[model samples]
Target chain A: MGTRAAGQVGRSGPVAWMALPALVFFLVFGVVPLFGVLVLSFTQWDGIGAINPAGLSNWRSVLSDPGLPHALWVTFEIMILSWLVQTPLSLLLGVFLAGRQRYRAFLAVLYFVPLLLSSAAIAITYKALLDPNFGLGAGLNIGFLTQDWLGKDNLALGVVIFVVSWQFIPFHSLIYQGGVRQIPTTMYEAASIDGAGRLRQFFSITVPQLKYTIITSSTLMVVGSLTFFDLIFVLTAGGPGDATRVLALDMYKRGFQANLMGPASVIAVLLVLIGLALALILRRLGGSTTASQQEGA
Target chain B: MAVATSAQATSRREAPGTSYGRKLLRLNWLGGTAGWLWLVIVIVPIYWIVITSFKDQSAFFAQNPFALPAEPTLANYQLVIESDFPRYFLNSVIITAGTIIPAVAIAFMAAYAIIRGAGSKFLAGVNGLFLMGLAIPLQATIIPVYLLIIKMHLYDSLLAIILPSIAFSIPLSVLVLTNFIRDVPKELFESMRVDGATEWGMLRSLALPLTRPALVTVSIYNGLGVWNGFLLPLILTQSPDKRPLPLALWTFQGQYSVNVPAVLASVVLTTLPIVVLYAIGRRQLLSGLTAGFSR
Candidate 1:
């Protein structure tokens, strides 16, 4: 294609030839590997063994597996929980900090510190913080709040959700701040002169104004929550009888731990499809609103 | 008598403060109080981690978890330094630097071409390729990546980790750099062209110099991502000697289940570099994020 395209340009040009490296890169690393993953999904091959074609047996087994459904449920539950908790809080914080106040910079830095730390670090820190004994929760007379967070079946996923939301809120706050900064200050001034209170101005001006950012941030949060693994893997390893076993972790266990590569591929494909579907829905909704918002502005 | 009563009643009806002033004062107080409370809540965990790292095992296990160490000792730091942490840190630095330099360089050139090149079709197709890389999550490609690493006899080596990190980061770097390059004045490139500068020369002399800020921002983004990565390193490196900081910290956790202080100490050590970087680059980081969103 590169050669053909270069020829079609009908100019003896070195500039067109410069694009070959990028083309090769996209082909080898991007396109070929994707095709390989798709094809390998249908075959039964251990990490070492020869590929034995199984003709969709892996897909069938993945569909029939009870564990996959449970994992999906856990994933969706955590995704929704994190979205519900983080979105509104981050928005409020962003709006509050976006104003010309002395402490706005200080507050932004304070909130963003968690996002810089490694997920493993955050997980380990929280595990210690929530320790049933010999930790803050114990020393502060809040032992009831700790409750064997990682060890208990009922509280395990909730603990993971809380930790995830804590790490991610700063990121969403930054996103919302960007959106809020784009909003013209004159709009707020006009509302104030019309005798509107702060709450009325916020609902009528801010929320309706930041619909695009809200959509983008929520989509990112949902996809991130659904496909999350590192922190959970490090903290609990999906233990305490699979209480916090999300679909991503389950897929990792099946593929890498148990060497069920075929079934793991199926789960991965499904996860991708779900993520794409969510992104599409968000873009469609935001598309209509963004047009109107632009026109209104 | 009636005139005296009217004057007294008129004076009594006036209160000390006006309604508008009182309400403004209350609103200011409420906003200030909420802002300070949020600051405390946000900083507490970080303070906990840092303070815990300086305490000895006994201090950590004592009754007061939140209290400052009575005799703040460097014992945990000594332990971390004496252990394999130095090697793990070196590996992490190598992998991160290796990935960032090449990824940023390649992305810069590709972005320049897409911005400067004539055909919209070609540019759009290239952009779509990078976007595809972003949408495909790592879980989907982990198996294939593992197999490819083994086939190339690169398992248990730093290259295995570095290659994948660079590959994954390219999409984002391209996205960011393209946006920045598009913002570059077109006359700069056109003038360089009229000066008889080749494409390579123009890239070196014009575009790269102009996009340094964006390059630094992208490098920081990629650096943090690679330094903190867990899955790729976990799968690629089996030898304890080759594992990076995150995986090394995981090993420490596994081996020292009873030694909470030591594990926390290692966590602190693992997170220090990034924490320091964030502290220095907080403003740039926020601006970069805003720039990314605007694009």
Candidate 2:
């Protein structure tokens, strides 16, 4: 593209300095801190105190700590459970919304309300609503609704997953909705003419065609779940015996709350690695041979 | 001629008012059930939040949790307002605007440069860096960001939050804006160049207007993010005067732990600005978000 311009216009195009401000800002704050997190992991700083070299001590302590594995498992559990709960519902809702119905549009507006609220606000709202004794269930005298939703281990984890899904499903569905609309109507017409029922067409056409979108949404869900700090911090504070302590929350607790910046940086590094790995895995899933075969078909 | 005719036939067959539109709208009981069922799940909590905000503290404990407040009062809202709510709201407004204006301006410039200077190795490398920046969960770098802010004498100030936010907002803003700018016809830029327009001139006149929707999308998206941001404020600032709405909401919840009505009222108060923004920009925000991600 630039060759065409250079040949005709007899000069170079836009100056590179136009991009310098943004590049410098990102490098200083984004790229530098990324490496800084790594560097800080090897040093001892009490978040506000004089820095001192700790070498591999931080790594040894964090690695040997059983809490590290438990936090990893908790993070993985929430990521997987939220993905499982959100994907199918988002796909179906996205397809239903692709139809140009006024009511569906209205429904979408209401559906997106959750996306507007801060995770802090949402967590707080649920905290009040889930109080076992004075909460909605207890007030209504409903036996099942009055359980200690955030007081027990399994139930606390379940409540976190449910709240996370409730907060995010609308956004993913919007992505899937956009994906659904982009699918050509001609394909659906052809399938209808072949006498395929709606369900068969959905399975054969809709699901297969949404392969990339599924990957995109899932990647966002999985990677984004790693940073579910504010919500869990407010909701559980990693309580009920540290049942809901994910890595990001773990980092916060270790660094800010406990003033263990060195060990916290180690956890932060692990989070970055895991997020990158999961994203790459999902991208590979999206670009697999089966997807290519479907495209060819 | 045959290819053109077949294309026309396909277009006619699939045009609106045809069976094609009706066929696609064929009822799916499962989707409908799921949609309506999910609507209930989404709406109930919100409904409860609004109605519960109106009840007085005593009435809250006495009434059914989901019932209408028999003696609704403004005391909750009153209590929330008298407790530094206005200062937090102002801080949020400043931080959001402060982060967004500079972030979007620089991002637009970068996006313009990257698109217009399409073959420049430096610009391409810069673009690639921004793209990779997308994959990084920048939140993980908060410890260092805190250090950077402290060393810069910025800790415990609104600027502490604003600077890093502008940096974080750049990657997505640049990506989305470049995608939009890349769609501008090259012939348009060429014609502008023929008229002796400089790159700056072309950016202001051609790319800027053409990409206004993208700019709005980026600004609103990043704005909402900075508005609702908790981790930065929680980590960076310690003063009560520096608290943003999310962190303010957190502390307020703690202080008023048993005063459910007051806490709920604060939640409603903090969220009202965004809900109003949503009501106004519903179409642009929704459509822009869909296009931005799916593209």
Clashes of each: 0, 0
lDDT of 1 by residue, A1-297 (tens): 332343535322455444456656556555666677777889998777898888989999989988888888888888888899888877877777776676687788888877777888788878788878766877777747657888887688888877887888877887888888889999878655544446656788989888878876887787677657889997788877887898889878998889888888888778778777776676677776565332111
Q: How much is B294 displaced in model 2, in angstroms?
A: 1.1
Residue-level lDDT tens digits of model 2 in A1-297: 744635756344455788999999999999999999999999999988898999999999999999999999999999999999999889999988887999999999999999899999999999999999778898889999999999999999999999998999998889889989988988878766654457667888989888878877887788889889899999999988899999999999999989999999999999989988887787677666654322211
What is the C-alpha lDDT profile of model 2 across B248-283, one tens digit per residue? 999999999999989999999999999999999888
Chain B alone, candidate 2, TM-score of 0.91
Q: What are the runs in model 2 whose C-alpha is more than 4 Å off?
A: A2-14, A288-297, B1-27
Which candidate leads the pack in DockQ?
Answer: 2
Interface RMSD of each: 7.2, 5.3
lDDT of 2 at A100: 94
Per-model fnat list:
0.32, 0.66
